[model samples]
Target chain A: MTALLERVYAWRWSVLPPITGVAMMAMIVGALVAAPREIIEGEVQRLMYLHVPAAIIMYVAFFFTAFASVMLLWKRDIRWDAAARASAIVGVFLCGIVLVTGAIWGKPIWGVYWSWDARLTSTLILFLIYCAYLLARSVAGPLDEQAARYAAIFAIIGVADIPIIQMSVRWWRTLHPQPIVFRPDPALPNEMLVVLLIGFVAVLSLATWLISLQTDTERAAQRVSALRAEFDHREIA
Target chain B: MNVLGAVVAKDLKLAWRNRSGWLSAAAFSTIAVLTYSFAFDLATGDVRPLLPGVIWTTFLFAGVFAAGQSFQDEVDDGTFDALMFSPVGATSVFAGKLVANLIALLIIEFSQLILATILFDVALLTPELLGIVLIGTIGYVSLTTLLATMGGHVRGRSVLLPVLSLPLLIPLLIGAVRATGASLGLEAGTGPWMLLLMVFAVWATLAAVLLFPTAAEQ
Candidate 1:
């Protein structure tokens, strides 16, 4: 079982991107051609195919960050710190996509580029927190263990705020429309549902690919730094 | 408890000597409120509806400067290292600083409230309003102090402090504004907002206590 898992993990880098590209193309075709227009929203509602999936992917990225951060704190391992850092960077990128797409979707529908609606507000806050996390990591000084520890702690605290923000925003109002696509009783027609499912799969794959690539780069950078330090030590000796 | 008191007392004395921590916060709050009052051209009666948001927003910005100052003193004087090395555990240090910030923020907030009443002509100085202020301020200060400690040693700390803390403080802001609105009779129910404030304060306090030691460690 472990060997099979290892094989799959090894193949992931090679396997993911192509599958993600294919799924993404399928999602686009499905959204634009196959799916019927909404009775009310018409074409603009199609943005949900990308916008909702991006938002979901952003959440997944942050969840990975929080998980990796906790692992770093518990294990005190540099690898875990690297994983957390990579995940947070991707999380921030995905969060930006979520916000921009959300604004684009809101303009025609809400009749304003922005509104103080709860979901948008909470998502904005989430984006800010992710940016802060990256800023804290950068300011912690490169290769500083204390920086990792601080970043880990900040990540944990920031993640804890997510649920509270959601709850508070929900209680504050129902101004933001309820989910129509991913709900148990999905309001989407069959074709739209199929497209959305493809979109989700494609986005998740893309996120995983990006995170893995980032983690690899971080690990390589750490290795180079360690090697440089060792070389300096040898020269001194 | 004794150690925690000593920590609070020490911070209070340090703040007293510096005097600028809370004073600048108060000044900032006053300037912010007055500026808003003028910029919006809000009449006395018009100010009543805007009171809760304007006051809370002012406090949020003022608290950032105040919280940043508390750690600036420690870091500049190299006392942060000393405190970390001290026999007193991290929780005591965190609690002491949290209490000190609470007192300082409340002072700034109250002064701001008084200034708003005078300048904006809003009657926001009632006892019930003060109660909401206490709950909201405690949660805000607790989280800020913790974030300040984390980012205190970083460059551009004044900017970094707010960036780190503001997102976490949103729920507090929402709750405080709602509760304040309810208290001022601008809204209907205070119960939910007050409960949110209490939950936020407790959660922030607990998170800080549990996490500060790890964050403070070298």
Candidate 2:
């Protein structure tokens, strides 16, 4: 199992980039050319393709971070920590995209660039929480085991907070658009749905590629730090 | 006394000895309320609309301040290391500190409520409001205590505490503010809001219990 996994890991760098590129190109064509423009929202409605997919992938990334965090705690694995860190970083970035794209879409529709509505506010809070997680990693030394453990614990707590944040914010106010996707009734047309699926593939593939690169970098940096410490110790002896 | 009682007693004593810490928090809350009143000119108009927001925001800040201080002295004096090594457990230390912090914050909050009543000329304390305060503080202190422990050794913790904690506490803040409004007759249907607060508190407490050991481990 380990050998097969190692082989796949080795080939991922070569395999992922081209696939992501092609997927992204396909999504772009599908979104811009294939999908018919909405009669009401026009061009700005197309932002939904980007905004929705990014939002979906952002949730994927953060939830994956939470899962990795739990694995890191339970298994005592550096790889899990690396994955958590990488996913969290990617999640924060994707969350930024979600907020920005949503704001752009909102300006065309809601007459303002921002709203204190339920979903918007909760997403904003999630973004801040993960930003703080990254900040904690930097401040406490990413290589530190205690930092890793604490980060893992923090990630779990953050995930737990998400539902409560949603519930509370929801009770506070909810003006964001209802679901066009993920419902039984399926509001979107077939072409738009295909484009959205393509966007999903593209964004998720991009996120996976980024997380893989980051995980490798983190492990390599740890190796370099370990080697330096060993070299210093030997020299002193 | 067992670990929990001893730690709680020790912390409460330390907090009493450092009376000015919470006094300063009280002072900050007072200024915040006063500033809001001045800014909104609550003297003439209805302060009811503004009262819930003011109360919860003040308590939120106070919770942040108290939770930040929860681990600072222990970390600074290297007593946290000893406590971690002690036979009892991280949960005990966490619960103790949580209780201590909760007591300190409640004191500050109670004082603030009285001051609000006097300044705004409104009845601020009622049974439902106190229940909301208790539950909100529980939710607030639980996560903040865990976070404070997690961030104790990190750099820029003073800044990081609020940055790390306030976002997590948004649900609590939302629930508390809305519930406070309801309890004070500014709004109706406090049940769901109170349920949110209770749910948040339970969630935070369970997370702390499950995570504090790892967070405080050497």
Off by over 4 Å in 2: A231-237, B1-3, B151-153
In the range B1-218, model 2's lDDT, one tens digit per residue, is 48789989988998888777778888888888888888889888788998899888888887787677777788888998998888877778888888998998988898999998898888878888889999999988888888887646566778878888888888898889999888888888899999999999999888887888888877
Worst 10 residues of 2 chain A by lDDT: A135-144
| Residue A158 alpha-carbon offset, candidate 2, angstroms | 0.9
DockQ of 2: 0.77
Instruction: Identify the CAPRI category of the predicted complex in candidate 1.
Output: medium
Question: Stretches of candidate 1 above 4 Å error?
Answer: A1-8, A230-237, B43-45, B151-153
Indicate the residue-level lDDT of A210 in model 1. 84
Best by TM-score: 2
Q: Model 2: per-residue lDDT, tens digit, A1-237?
A: 989989998988898899899999998888788889899988888888888999989999999999999999888887788889999999999999999999998998999999999999999999999998887777754467888888788788888889888888898899998897899989888989999999998998899999999988888877887788789999999
